[model samples]
Target: MSYVQQVMEQAIKRSPNEPEFHQALKEVLESLEPVIAKHPEYEKAGILERLVEPERVIMFRVPWVDDKGNVQVNRGFRVQFNSAIGPYKGGLRLHPSVNLGIIKFLGFEQIFKNSLTGLPIGGGKGGSDFDPKGKSDNEIMKFCQSFMTELCKHIGADTDVPAGDIGVGGREIGYMFGQYKRVRNLFEGVLTGKGLTYGGSLVRTEATGYGLVYLMDEAIKDIGKSFKGATVVISGSGNVSIYAAEKAMQLGANVVALSDSNGYIYDKNGIDLKTVKQLKEIERRRIKDYLEFHPKAEYKEGFEGIWTIPCDIALPCATQNELNEESAKALVANKCFAVGEGANMPSTPEAVKVFHANKIIFAPGKAANAGGVATSALEMSQNSMRYSWTFEEVDAKLKDIMVNIYRNASSAAKEYGCEGNLVVGANIAGFLKVANTMLAHGVI
Candidate 1:
């Protein structure tokens, strides 16, 4: 076996039961064969080994009081994967599915995602298995306080800066930031995704979803096409999905479908973003409620059926492995031309193969959905300067960053002979920057 294969085997064995981490490592390492082939020193210097191993893995217990005065407990994790280029930067997910494997997978992906942004942020990820659903505001506040009490010790503005993900939204960030400020007694930008009254940026709320569209726009244009008059089916009705749908419609695509964990809503008349925001953002109701307003639309009971909807473009803004080989094949069968991932590792490897086999323009999440972290880094810079930029200014910068990200990944693919394989290109392009930085800084 080759050196990369040997390292990969050792990684899987060392991190047993971490299937997500294993999958992430395998996918990243698979593309890096060309990189290690050209630079054998990467193997000799043990950079791959070191890169796979995190600098720190923090696991703690969070105890909070619910509204009923019941003491609830949850597990929390913070994996600082790499800081070769700069401080650790990523989001903190608050969902029941959060585990060591999931955190590790996200952190591992973050190393490359942050690198692809052309920013000076390294990679880290932290979150808890705490479910924010159906929790009262007071209960959520208590949980955020308890979670940050332990998290603040390991993070700083100059260290690992965490933002929000999954269940961690603006409301959660506010609670956590307040707790951090209380305990740390510092008003630094230790966290991103804060509210506007605080140090948060204007366009931060819409960055990731908008950025995904921005990257997809560039990809479609390169192929002599555009989103104009196209039909789009997007999964997830959360922050990323809503904004992606909004932006796609603004660019002339009829966003026909969107879903949540429960089910999906499909309206041929195009989804009403105002109702979606009200249902999801304010009312905090399931997507099934969308039918109450759009009586002409169809509401499906299963999340799987969302993919079967005929559309020109598909955006998987939901969680990992939501789009599998079966779904990818279904998408191709329906003649979907593009798949833009707004969530990390949203498409499985088999799904990726299916897309490539069909010649679909697949934009990986790291490059397409990088707008969130890129904007988080921007928020970090603004917080450091004690200033903020207007919505237009930040939006423009985000667009440029996303366009450059596509070009860099595309060119890297061309350089390595992968041509249009953004997966290989994104992995290699990001790994090269981080690896070279590690080489320059010398192994820690």
Candidate 2:
């Protein structure tokens, strides 16, 4: 190992409790091995050490009132990992699983993902351990308002801009933006996933999912393959999976499966995208409810089984570490050719190793799902210019961005002597850009 690798390994060993942080840093450092050897300035600057640690981590209590006149409190976190490229920009997730580790992982991945977008944005992520599921609209609004009450103090248009993730979607963004506007007493582009009335960009909702498929399309085309007649299995029925399914259908692929936390539903005849959108987005119901709408579909009680179903492509749109080594093995054993992560770090390091060793065309979340934040940055541009691009225009731009991102990653891997390894490619591509900026800016 090189000096930089030794230093990074030692630093991670010293912080064993921070496995997510270590895993994210290790992946980047491993990919940048060749770059570190070439650019000794990065080693001298201790970029790896600085990059492993977040610039700032904020945690606070979010107290709210329920319709029953009861008080509830949840923990909120924001990990501002790096701002060498620009201001801190990412998303706010509102799920029961929110924690420091989860936020750190997401923020670390955001750093690279944002860098790949070629937009002037840094990396940050924040969220609360408040589950929006089963909550009434009024209850969710109260929770979001309360969560934003404290979050608004630390964020702004130029300082830190947050969008939506997981449980935090249009409704949550609406409530949070309303609270921020009320508290700050100013209407600014402080958040990206805002409603159209409040300056949200057209096609922002479909950006990430569409971007994932776009990246997948690019990767397959590079290998003389196409999405036509490809069988796909997607985890999570949220915005990402819903639109990914839509785009996959448009590309002539059959998306056979989709999942929620409760379980996943598989249909041999291909899933009905409209029914999923209505159940997950409109009704806010569970995945099990799909059985009521389509009796022919098989609903399993866990998400892991989704991978076991035979398919040509797999998209893990659920939470982090959703696909483990076992699931990855199942996919590869079933002749899965591609895996694109729509969710942050949905595959474990072991799962990634399996995919890489088996030569699967794997696209990391940072590279594949960057479309969301890329469009969010575009939204910021529109907010500043007081104009919004049409959906077709924004989508066309998104496709171009994804194509460039894939080329950047592919080229980075080749330059680093790790050709065909996207994990390394993405890390090197993202790290070099941010590291160079940090070197130019000096210690801060």
Candidate with best TM-score: 1
Count of backbone clashes for each model? 0, 0
List per-prediction Cα lDDT, in the order shown. Answer: 0.95, 0.90
Report the number of the highest-lDDT candidate: 1
Candidate 1 stretches with Cα past 4 Å from truth are none
- Per residue, candidate 2 scores C-alpha lDDT tens digits across 6-112 of 87778777667777777777777777778888999998998887887889999999888988999999999988989999889999988887778778888988999
**What is the per-residue lDDT of model 1 for residues 1-444, given as tens digits with 9 covering 90 to 100?**
988999999999999999999999999999999999999888878999999999999999999999888999999999999999999999999999999999999999999999999999999998999999999999999999999999999999999999999999999999999999999999999999999889999989899999999999999898888999999999999999999999999999999999999899999899999999999999999999999998999998889889999999999999999999999989999999999999999899999999999999999998999999999999999999999999999999999999999999999999999999999999999999999888887768
Listed per candidate, the RMSD to the true structure in angstroms reads 0.7, 1.4
- What is the TM-score (0 to 1) of candidate 2? 0.97
Worst 10 residues of 1 by lDDT: 435-444
Off by over 4 Å in 2: 9-16
Residue 116 error, candidate 2, Å: 0.4
